[model samples]
Target: MLSRKASCDSHGQDSSYFLGWQEYEKNPYHTVHNPTGIIQMGLAENQLSFDLIESWLRRNPDIVGLKRDGESAFRELALFQDYHGLPVFKNELVDFMAKIRGNRIIFASNKLVLTAGATPANETLMFCLAEPGEAFLLPTPYYPGFDRDLKWRTGVEIVPIHCSSSNGFRITSSALERAYQQAQKLNLNVKGVLVTNPSNPLGITMNRAELNHLIDFAIDKNIHIVSDEIYSGTVFDSPKFVSIMELAMERELYNADIWNRIHIVYSLSKDLGVPGFRVGMIYSNNETVVDTATKMSSFGLVSSQTQFLLASILSDKKFTEKYMKETQRRLKKRREMLVSGLRNAGIQCLISNAGLFCWVDMRHLLTSDTFEAEKELWKRIVCEVGLNISAGSSCHCSEPGWFRICFANMSQETLQVAMQRMKAFTDSSNSAVSQQQFVNNTRARSLTKWVFQLSSYESEPHR
Candidate 1:
């Protein structure tokens, strides 16, 4: 028998919810032969914009260097991508980031490090920032994949800063303090705090105030702050995104140390709806982190061809600007449709303004208020209802009876079918509950009448 490392052995049983969802995708119920197909609302994907991207690509055949003038450019892009990334790619990325952040902040090419995707970017940061046993604070009800991205290989631990739903699951100072104290109690070295702005499960963007609190907390603790802003371009409403870079720039006027500790991870997967391209970047004001992560990029560098293709496309200011606007508009419309459909089914989701998914409240659907009960409900939703939405337990949500429903991954007709199934389930559940209540009421009334008759007979004189 081959002996594996202790880390691998200990974590081998820990399965990823995403990998499990893939199994469902392989032979999904919704195929041609299967009438009741599985409707997957679990994956955070943006399939809604594929047609637009494909059409644009078709219109611009020059993007592939197929044009006579672009032949040399295509050949150059087909070569090996540097660990530090192509300068042109880096330059275009900086401009794109500045544009999306409302141009309030600007990034230099030296500050950016390229990786395969945000997953590797996060793993690289974990390796660079923290030691094997150190912990990073994460706001609870976070993205489930963080476990695999940040901790699985790096040996880092995640200490959740439990955020409550009462205030829309917003991260608070008190929660930060509690998480810090809890880490201390466990005798773990707290190295940093990782936050996903335009959060994954919640789909809510953090306001300036919350960002300030996080900055202050990190400064006070003298720990690092890793801001995952992959969904920055997905914002559709108010409380617009405020990048950590912007905050650091403003603060550097008074305190320069803050800049040294801040790092950001970004990707085009969510924004461009090109997860297949696997382009991810890390931008940091900290020189040491920038250099180290750049060197670490050797393990998972973005393909040269992909970098070249994106660089050419992103450099087109007119196209990028228009694309961003249209993407947001479509996202907002889809979000509204999903919210309305769920509402019609009496399934209330947490109010969200960004990202591809929503935190749906399903506590009423659970058999009991426990993670085990949540798992059962998840099974019923997947197997019976044929809709594969993620369970709250899988996302490290402290509370049960919540799920993340991705709205941009399916067609309008498929989404409608999912809503119908959910509504049917809810209606059936309600009917069953009502019938049980009626049975209990009838039993209670019969018992009351029997007791009264017995008392009356006794009162008539010991009959």
Candidate 2:
């Protein structure tokens, strides 16, 4: 009835990640109205720092009004803008990026390409980097959204570089070799490797050794390394973030072939708690790539007014610095609360230092050590326990029984309610049933009656 990608489930929004979101939306939990309904823990959104943004906007009404010192500039902001983006915003954007990375390296504004958001930025990169049927490797337990962002429209393929839980799901040289070999076996052309630093599902940053290994792999394979560093600013704890560029500089890969091959996908969505702004960027050493991306960016330009407002916000060094510290402080507090809540429920999560979510281990809760059992447990948690979380399987995790539970998007009271629900579910599931009995019991429920589907939010892959 339409294009093959459109006609198929390849877009990947129909799976556990999104289905849970559907269930949550249908009967969302509210303290006053629907306390028994599902608490949405599936989305990886940052809402903790909106107050700072509001405060800043309130103080700068002229910026908010697209005016300079009370003089209206609405006509200029409302008119068409170049795909190259506002020079002021791009300049400040890089400065913000540099400040986030502890100012280890400075980014060239001309080398940056602007897009509507990280999703489109990634897609645009895939369009420039690889052809249909070409593949890029990804680490397991990745953000579920990459399936749509990197592959859906581009016809690019994702070959998972499986990381083991034994090493905290850290990337290893052996995994890269295995993944590349696997791609070769499938007769696929390898384009590059895509990674999320302060990773999405795992919420941990890649160390220096791993970054060096990635550079080695890129050089050896003659491929690129697309580091999705949208969560760079979300790193709240120590052993602080080490950007791939920082390492590249230390190793002096600048202006080299390896340098040009490294591209970064960054966004204001997670860092600013403003997904509505739709401002994302790609910073590469390859000028041709930046130019090509800029041309392609016309298809998804950042609105000029949004750029004007952000330019005003970011240029205030004091405000941005304070905002950064405050954001980290709140994120750390929320992270501790979620972890504490889980611990109270007799659950443990991967020790994470960044991002809006926790990679929770409910492996002990499953009746069997298989993905089917994982899905079974996931369904029960989402449908019965009244919480929606992304299953590890959707993140292409090698093992079962892990889930991403987001804490930044909800209120403290709601989070407490979710903690209580999780505790109740954990307590009830203590007297575990055999796999057969578990399957039979789940079969007895009216699945369709409760999980009526209506869906988006680019759901976490399968969100």
Candidate 3:
């Protein structure tokens, strides 16, 4: 028998992406041995920038202290990093974040706390803000990892604010209020609201008005606001990325108190295409939160060697700027390709401006309107179609029949194949439906004819 907490730790097994990846690892599409291997479009990863990143790294060999600064500096970097993060790394990160957000936001190094990744950064914040069993309100169709990141170890709860597709899934004040009220009804203590601007799955960036509404709601309720901006640099189209830091500054000009409650989580994974590097940051104006999280970061601090290399790369103003522009250009190209391919297949995707994936509607293809039907369709797509895209249910979406399809995870060739597979699946499904309808119609007509003949015979004849 497991403890109650142990029993609750089911996110890993529950996550579709995890299961999909497991299958993919067993037989990847790129391998010759597995010709009909799975095409993994479920994980939000940016493999498009690998060539660019590799080129940049080659140009800056001194990042490893091979040329400049000698062996001593290299040795120093190889040692344990400060729990609060190396000063040089923090300074470079501050600049990198500002540059990506169009310099509209300024980050202070002292306020930054580094963790292994955004997952740990979020967990750190949850620990600092809420006690065990307390809740944070998240918008529905959120990043599925939040359940594990925020709640797994810390015992924090998530209350979802249901945003409907009718309104482009934008978070509204009414939705926030409804979630808060629902939390209250459940006797849960609501601590804060968590938002992913340039949301995961949906890939939509929240406009300024929506962000302002969030600020107002938090102020009215005196609750904390955590904005996860990990995908800040991944924005391709306009209504550009807005940082909570930028909003917090504007609010501070009038009311300084809100700064203490506003926190931002950022990472290098999506933007820099460096998930393996494990760089994540927590920037907060609250000194106490910063101090607490800094202390908590020791258990999962980034490698000193990784920090040193990234610091040097990020500090290179010219390379960093060029890299940002090129990354966005490639991401935009990939996004258009994926969206166009999906649309051509008669599949509709949510309007998304940023992020690595898009929210796709597959409801019409479902056997029914229920989540169980959604699961069945998801299974068919994975097992039959060999395309692994995440089901919206995994992301805590209120509605069924949606899935998040990652566009940047594969080569163009692989993506084309995946799209083709999706089209084939849809075509076959439609054909099956048409065949079933034809069979039903034929049966109905035969039954009607027999009934009419029987009525006519009984009326004329021998009674």
Candidate 4:
């Protein structure tokens, strides 16, 4: 194992990027003081809170669907007579989760367990499922949090499957098999596979048949499946989102006639648009897995208030139906707008069939240093052009040149203007090779200025 010092020297202070929580907590007020923090993708929720919710309610009064509010389902629990019996409200919440999720084949029985949100749940799963020497496989241009959370917490080996440009950032079973073969050659522990459906950053989804192949591979290898289904309900294209758990259930029922270990994790943060709620759930059929996760986290339970709110919202079928429809409509439109704009700008992106983001590949134009170059582009757009979007470098384990542009939060007009600014920037960058050369030439200018100042001081001979 590399010493922390050696790792620090190799990776440099870039490791500081992973120290997000404690560092942010220390000075979050700074961003508040700055006020110009427009369209930050770092935080999970809209800052407007009650006003936004109320406005959403007013604009579409009939859109009572609360598909994203995990706590909203529990609102009706208040009317229940007792907490125990044939129909305890909490039990209903559990059963409802099992039913809706189970019907989808996300019932990993013992393999699945719910957590506060994807982060802790993911970190816990990585720790539990992966041995110190084992390899955990994730797609390239992956979720940034998964890489950070895994390494920071468990120190396990991470294997990334880089999807090619021809494939549109989509991972195939062949890709997994190749990764598996590579892992075997390296003699890696080859513990588990982590995948996100309707993926983050890329915004693409896998079909049922595709998912089944992956599940079968995991089962055959006797390895665990870590499925991040946070965006499961946010499908934009046809075929919908098919889950590995559902595939596992199907395989157990027909193919293998035996249970396979697959773990599915979801969070209310994305779908509910109430990221602050910080509620997450995991599901699996592996008893040992669930038992271990519960023991690790059983010291505390989800907040009673949030749970009640989720219960209220979820049980309201009429509300959820309407909400989901409108949400999907808006998401689909926004995705189209962004993809179209990116295409017009000559920037290539993975076609987002589902989810709230678009994965933009900018390697053809620029390379990211600590992904800072991509962020600088966003800052330029935000500052010079009054536009805000996510940079892709934050999504993957490898140093990525991609940017994730989110369409869920911005107004249409703002999005259009942002796209125009981005187009202009790309065009200007292409035409302005001299600009970079000039900046490089100016590196010694400051030193020259300092030398002149020292000469002036020597002549003066100050006391």
Candidate 5:
């Protein structure tokens, strides 16, 4: 026997979103080997600007050698394993974050707590802010991994604010009120609200009205606001990504008590296409949280080797500037290609402007307007259409027919093959739906006649 935590299925990895990944791995589509096999569009990874990163890495040979200024810094870094992290790395990291936000928000290296990645960064924040069983309110159709990262080991609960597609799933005052009340009914102390600006599933940035409303609600409720901005730099189109700290200053809330309660989780996983490095940060004005999270970083600290490599790369302003611009240009083009391809298949997205994926409406493709139908449609898409995608239900979306289809993980030619497959499937589905409607109508008429005959027989059966 093992500990309950080890044995239990609380990690939430069995969700369909992840299962789709399994499906992709089983029969992956390759342009050369398996052109007709399933093409993976379920992962939110950025492979667009790796060339730039690689070019820089090639030039900076000393980074891997652990040498600075033609000398060795290996021994010092090798022996160093403090939770405080390398100051050079932190300084450069925070400065890089500022560059992503248009040099608008200046992040302090002192207030930043480094973790292995965004996953642990979020879990660490939950540990700092809430006791076990306290809750965080997340909007509907959120990043499904939150189920595990925020709750699995921490024992925190996630209450859905249940934003609707009516207003493009924008967080609303009414939805917030409803969610908070629901949490109250469950007798859970709402510790905070977590949001992903340049939202993971939606690929849409939160407008200022929504941002102000969220901050005000958090202030009124006296709850922490954890803004997960991992995809901050991936924002390729307008309106640009808005850091909560930036907005707080604009509204003069930076000087208020609310600023202390506002925490941001940032990572190079999405922005820098370096998930393997596992570099994540937590920035907060709350000194206690920063210190507590720093202590917690011992469990998932970024390795010194990774810190050095990143420091070298991020310190090169010329490379970072060119990288960001070229990255945006490529992402915008890739996004356009996916959008245009989906349009040819009669599938329209949620008018998203950022992120590596599109939250497109596939409700018309569903057999019925229900989550069950969403699952069925998803199964068909994955199995029959040979495309791996995430259904809205996996994201806790209340509505059906929406899916997150990623575009940045594969080549343009591979994407074209996927689009061709999607177009064929949709065309067939439209015909099948029409034929099924006729079949249903005929079955209804036959059932009515059978009922009349059965009633007449019953009336004479007394003999």
Candidate 6:
């Protein structure tokens, strides 16, 4: 039976106050101290990636930190605008945009270009492009933002192309076809395909050859392509990162299909490891789309300082190359360390090539809802063993039995310690679950009473 706190909302929607006022009040503590946030995984980005900006500042240490209210970074705002033929006082934003007519960067295209970050970019693109009845296909268990961003921002329908543990959570062309076919039968208009290279939760980068097939498919269907290449420069141990832009740029020479229609959205944020800098580029040969996005930007306004800082950084080739290599080296080491730990503990991890995340399967233990398992898992880690991870179910995939671990922010020692804590938590959970099953056997009893039992899992084997 539902408890007094489990009553419906004012709208008669069911809500559960599982924990009392004290536990609810302590929520922020649980979230902030959690390993996912605190453990220093490499996912948060590195300062080394922004060495260019730092170097510039060091050279001009006397420069004032002023809020620049301006229109374009290319001319009036950017440091190297003059080098790129931008006159410091001239209106070169339109001219700079005109130079690149079409873009081929996967994950960084016109359909979904730059916005503070990929999240808003995805939301705006889907909102503007997806018609009232259109369906946007996403890989199951992908990024969480895709689900929340689209839902809260637009009225378009979402059609998930489910990926499963059996396939190692890798999405395939066949899956795309099936989702399209199903949407067609349901009279859903499918307008575009959005895929994340080195996907957020999965960390699986599609092979270039397979990407070509996808491009061909989109071309034939006349669907827009939104490739999230925010992680574009992060691929490790793979063939050099290949983009749809290279192929699209090539194809445009002969086919109207490849012309200024494809869009590319790139950001200095992720690869540069400076999310706070918030500088991203939208490249499109399609004048109509680029013009539309620019108009949108005029209303939204770009921070002049951010633009200048980014332009300064991008102008330095040596600075960019050095940082990129260093970041890759560090991330590679972290990935290996995490993989080794998981393996030693008998947990399975899908190895990723060029990204900061690894998607792990816990379906056997989770069995039901991915989100529910993650919610429980996160709590267990925080209250029990002091470990944390991004719940796999948060990404709006069909499955929630998986969890994603980010390697972008942590030091090696910290990661090892956190992993050990997670291992201990695993043991504690197993022990408590066994005992709780007996307490839950009674039909009339409230099984949730045992949630407190988890505190024992937290306090015992004291860290």
Ranking by TM-score: 1, 3, 5, 2, 6, 4
Residue range 89-151, candidate 3, lDDT tens digits? 899999899888888877889999999999999999999999999999999889877878888
Instruction: Please give the CA lDDT of all the candidate structures.
Output: 0.86, 0.91, 0.87, 0.62, 0.93, 0.58
lDDT string for model 5 (75-109, tens) is: 87888689999999999999999999888988899
Task: List ranges where model 5 is wrong by over 4 Å.
Answer: 437-463
Scored against the true structure, residue 171 in model 1 reaches a CA lDDT of 90
Ranking by lDDT: 5, 2, 3, 1, 4, 6
Reference-based TM-score of each model: 0.95, 0.92, 0.95, 0.72, 0.94, 0.72
TM-score of 4: 0.72
Encode model 6's per-residue lDDT on 1-463: one tens digit a residue: 8843345332211111122112324442223364333342323364433445566668644333432342332434444221112222112222222222222332322333335555555665665567666887776766654555565436577788877677766667788788889889889998877777657777767766657766777877788777767777676666556666666655653357545545555555667677775555455666666656655544333465655455444544466567667777876777788888876665778767877777776655552565666567655554455444655545655665666777666556677777786676556666777778766676325545566577778888976
**What C-alpha root-mean-square deviation, in Å, does candidate 6 show against the real structure?**
11.5
Those runs of model 2 whose alpha carbons end farther than 4 Å from true positions after fitting are 431-463
Clashes of each: 3, 6, 0, 45, 1, 30
RMSD of each: 1.9, 11.7, 2.0, 10.6, 3.9, 11.5
lDDT of 2 by residue, 1-463 (tens): 6877667888888878878888999999888888788898998899999999999989888887789878999998888888888899999999999999989999989999999999999999999999999999999988888888888899999999999999999999999999999999999999999999989999998998899889999999999999999999999999799999899999898767898999999999999889999999999998888989999999999999999999999999999899989999999999999999999998999999999999999998887999999999899988999999999999999999999999999999889989988898887676344555677768755454344432233343761
Clashing pairs in 3: none
lDDT of 1 by residue, 269-382 (tens): 999889989999998878899899999999998888788788878988988898899989999999998999889888899988899998999898787989899888888888
